[model samples]
Target: MTIPLKLHVGGMDCAACATKIENAMKRLPGVTDISVSYGQELLSVTLDEDRTSRAVIEGKIRALGYTPAGSDVARTPANDAQAATAPWWRSPRGRLVIGTAALLAVAYIVSHIEPSWATWAYVAATAIGLVPIGRRAIVAALSGTPFSIEMLMSVAALGAVAIGQAPEAALVIFLFSVGELLEGLASGRARAGIRALMDLVPRTARRLRGSEVETVPVEALQIGDVVLVRPGDRVPSDGDVIDGTSGVDEAPVTGESVAVLKEPGSTVYAGSIGIDGELQVKISRTTADNTIARIIHAVEEAQATKAPVARFIETFSQWYTPAAMAISLLVIVGPPLLFGADWFTWIYRGLAVLLIACPCALVISTPAAVASGLANGARRGLLMKGGAALETLSKVKTVAFDKTGTLTRGKPQITDIVCLAGDENDMLAMAAAVERGSSHPLGLAIVAEAERRGLDIPRAFGGSSVTPGKAVTARLKAGFVSVGSPRHAAGKSALTPDQADRVAALEQAGKTVVVVLQGAQALGMIALRDEPRPDARAGLEKLRSLGVRSVMLTGDNARTATSIGSLLGLDVRAELLPDAKLAAIAAYRAKGPIAMIGDGINDAPALAAASVGIAMGGGTDVALETADVALMKERIEGVAALISLSRATMSNIWQNIALALGLKAIFLVTTLVGSTPLWMAILADTGATVLVTANALRLLRYGNRRSD
Candidate 1:
């Protein structure tokens, strides 16, 4: 049996560290799969427990110079963040950098005082910092990772000292330590941005007790309990407003800059601030089920899945590192042996080339941009499953939409009532009784309409039968009642020309017309319309501007579907069953990668069939579980926004790659010619890492866009 293991990993600064650990762990017995997420600091492994155990895996991670949850290493930057608000010099890694600087300063002053003691002084300074780097390099080598950045740094510094360049070696070690400190600071900043989501929900709440409000922890707030939201306080949980009115700022959870007005019966999300008037809200979900918690979970899980471009770069780097090491070695020995060149000068250039060989900048290029993109999407109420989904969405050539919900609002309302034989109220009451407990959207709409009109609904006589995608039927005291699609009623008997004309007019008007029938006699028809979402037209236009096509695939009748699709200028494929929807998706795949957007149980098959599945609303559990991407808000614009964001992320990744390689390529040329200084080489490598991370951070602004 395969067992899954999940653990928090510490001290991994970039994707290179993750790749190193993955390579070493994959060589272990019974290790079926291993994934290390650098952005999330999480390790997920699948293995056969009979052959190997958690203890062995964790031990291997520790051996690779990373701090696993249970294993304590000599120094961990993750441990250093316990006083996260403190100055950088106070952390353990910070202290090392400070201490090393002090030693280098002391050695420099003494060397100036006595020329004879210069060599020994610099050697002493180099030894202080080299001890830790050398230990890490040796540990990494034994664990099957022989060419890590630490190994390159250690080898370069040691080789310099062996050539009687103690002063230059000391300077190299000092610069390397400072470079490491900068990397930690930058990586820590990015990680903190992701973790800040958890802090949005406050710890405590004000639960109402009779006439009084009592302070309590948010965890103690139960479903159906009303909590008071004072002005300027964030709502403690997902709930509905039951009292008062206020302009609530939802920017914290959903990136809208404007405040949303909250009134009675309005649904409010957790972590949104109530700006003006105080309101009492009834809790709907526990904290873990709220928007903030779910978004955090999604981002963390996404880090485990790499994009195709990322995979290619990682593979390229695996060979690139060893090839670089060979070239560095040739620079040191080849020229000196063949052309009788100056050995000392060639060796100095070789050390500079070694610094350029560290793959930190190249390794981090894609994941960094992806991490920022995920964060941006989360803030905008877009939840993509992973890097792969984010990348695939950008390639989508056509977006197929489920008409009832994706483009139109999923909520259907009663529009028109036609009377044939009985009074409208009496006929509606019969349909409502049969649909009283049905969870279907159409049935619920009927029940809600009947209740709103103050009709008296009698009890259903016996067990009710449902036609999967059609309607419901049950026996009433007078006779049998059936409320379903117009086609379902038409099959039983012929409709009068006048009645048929009315139904045709309603259906042509883009309304869903259902026949209310008693046995074979048609009593009347009810027309329900689900209007197109406010952003439907604009969003589709934006998609077209990006060179993507739009299509509507629905189970709705041809007239209704075409009418609705024409509103947004979309291609219509109407009257599709669930199987047909899946077939349509497979056919669309032949044109190019397609995305299916939906919000219902039947849409699941099509969602799974498409290259990318986007769930339209946050409320549907089936869509949430099955779709590759989910929009927490009903804003259709988010679909286009996410695709635009994905394209921007890919563009950002290419820029990072060019920068990482471009800088290294220039340094490599200069190093071979003995022109580039050793310090400048190490400085460029560290600078590249920080610069790539900083560039990725630019995507954070996407979260703050005023509107989609």
Candidate 2:
């Protein structure tokens, strides 16, 4: 006897808004269940054939301040016109009509005017309001759909009219409309946060070709094309700097407040604003693959994916609506027929039961809880892409982390330089001269060290050539110089026994020792290794306490990985390739839910394939785009906080759902047995909504909770 109904609902803008609509629909007597998605602007409801008509469902939505499009009420064109012409509540003068009816009811209730005249006036005002608002409900009930919430309200109003109690009818309709309007307004505001993120990407870009800058659509900019960005302009594409240098304000991308200096060879992201310089950048990614574009895609996907509990509500609403309507009809009509009460009065009461039985409350309970949870997460530095990710995070039993940038400070510096046969000054001078022409991070560190020591590097060394994972060889006035890894220099037998021993000692300490030699003899060994981030140990301990097992995965060799793992007290150490890391995550996922934290291009695949992937804010575009959650502040403590927050948010959502449904069940039982009045129905519907909303808001304190 249950019929499925899909409605396109307007005025929903966030998860919270979707919750409000779902709740409002569930509260209706005939509605069995409901699902509302703010991202899709869609609402699906199930209703009982014997108890509710489509008109009642539509009317309930209208009362809550939403226009239901494509429902059986057949107001599609009118709804579309209303959407185009004015706000849902303001259009068709529904609010004004309800207001006039309300004023007349209030005057009659308080005045000493002639009772007969007051009754007639109230009836006339009710008729005026019902003609526009309740007409659909009346028609739907007559059309074999019977017992909709709207029909119930209409029948009650007409009964009041028939019995000469016009003021009551007007009051009921006016109050219903007020509730609808409040729900609509609340839903609209909740969706605004996600919409704001979408607004950051510009639709166009300016391409600089042969000194001519021409504006083109963002999608048309191909890789290798040069794009010109002016000061105060947002980068329309992700690219490498080809010309010019400037400070870029990357707050939108990294969530940091400071502007980062950008010189030649620096990388820039889409949607980041240029603060002080013009830039000519060679596009590295297509518009579809750009940072902002991927962010939008991820957020959209997240919003569309329902949480597990949300899916249950969707399935529940599919049947709950129609079943509730039939039960309400049986409750109202069967008892009276057996007892031989007046048929009309019994039918009227049955209709009241139907109106009160609408499933508005049940439909919204879960979604509102989700919206509030997501918003609260965003407010704290954790950006949960969707309900699914939020749900996954809560259930994660194992957390895997990438070592280099995630656990240790990504930028390692030269901590020590050991001289072998030569004096310290000579060894450093030659090494710095060779490294000065190289661009590797280690080379940069050596150059910095030499500069710090006030050693002048001769300019006579021609440009250097670098071999990946090997060494940088340069032509210097003294001779051909090489500064590189120990393996590369060792192949040439450049180190003496004493110098090799010294380098071995440095390497054993988990430092990357670079040996500098001019062909035959060892010069000196310079060690570089990322220091552990200050919060690394504390964060790891927190995760352990939370019962989430922690593992460290790194591309670094076993020695380095083992050293870091031991220092941080990780339960497992995985020194792996990108594929090995991904396999490890998949294997872990087989046992239960797992979360992976990484921040490199190599980590992108694993990050995407994990149950939950968290990326550092300053990580590569691929990693950031692939991650489900982003830690805006690159700190290990934030990772622990994110996990804790996710668990807390999920708990809050479940609690809200339980409370909302529990209240509804109690109300339904009481109403069915005649222990509750029509006024009680109104209070339960509205009051439960308020309570669910308040409960969901508790997620706002997720991160700040010390024990959590």
Identify the leading candidate in terms of TM-score.
1
Structural similarity to truth (TM-score) of each candidate: 0.81, 0.73
| Clashes by residue pair, model 1 | none
lDDT of 2 by residue, 1-708 (tens): 888887877655344345546666665677876777675477777888678877877776665445666654422223433454456556434475457656666557644566546766777777776764576564444443343445556665676577655666666666655555555545544444444444455667889878788999877999999988899888887899978999998777655557888878999987789988999889999876776556554554565678888788756754665776677678667877788766655554554555555555555666665665665555444566788888888888988888877888877788788877667877787788877756677878888888989987865355787787888878778787788888887788887676678788877778889988777667778898787888899988888888889988787888777767787888555557777877888999999988888873557787887898887765355444557887755667766677777677667766766776677678777765657655455555556666565565555444454544
Q: After superposition, how far is residue 486 of candidate 2 from its true place, in Å?
A: 5.3
Candidate lDDT values, in order: 0.82, 0.69
Q: After best superposition, candidate 1 residue 215: deviation in angstroms?
A: 2.4
For model 2, the run of ten residues with the poorest summed lDDT: 72-81
Please provide the root mean square deviation of candidate 2 (C-alpha atoms, Å): 8.1
